[model samples]
Target: MTLAVFRSFPDFPPYGGEFEDLMPHLTVARDGTPAEMRAVEREVREHVPISMLITDVQLMCGSNALTA
Candidate 1:
């Protein structure tokens, strides 16, 4: 399942979700290897649901940058 919107957690463990200048995005692929991620993306386009609800959230920093 996947969502195409931003989400936030009220509070997360360890650091309590207090990072600065943070933004959330829909996670398309969770695979470690780039090849595996690509394969998963293909499957996601075919089988993922149109809508999804996030239950629990774990905050983390990613290296990717968002562009306009």
Candidate 2:
């Protein structure tokens, strides 16, 4: 899927093609202060093992815009 996206938009490679392999992840928080980040980590650790069904995905790009 990543490769296909790269092919379609040669100018906008995933992560600017910086990484050799991509690891699936979920962003819990962004730009949080150190103390806030620690609090988030503690909260997340309380639910160490999370499970869910990902039935669909939406590709977003370009600064708060939904691309697809």
Best of the candidates, lDDT:
2
Error of 2 at 38 (Å): 0.4
Clashing pairs in 2: none
How do the residues 1-68 of candidate 1 rate in per-residue lDDT, one tens digit apiece?
11221333333322343555444446765546888888878887896455657676444544442221
The TM-score of candidate 1 is 0.33
lDDT of 2 by residue, 1-68 (tens): 56766787799767767798986667788768999999999999999677777765555666655322
**Which runs of model 1 end up more than 4 angstroms from their true locations?**
1-25, 53-68
Top candidate by TM-score:
2
Q: How many residue pairs clash in each candidate?
A: 0, 0
Q: How well does candidate 2 score on lDDT at residue 68?
A: 28
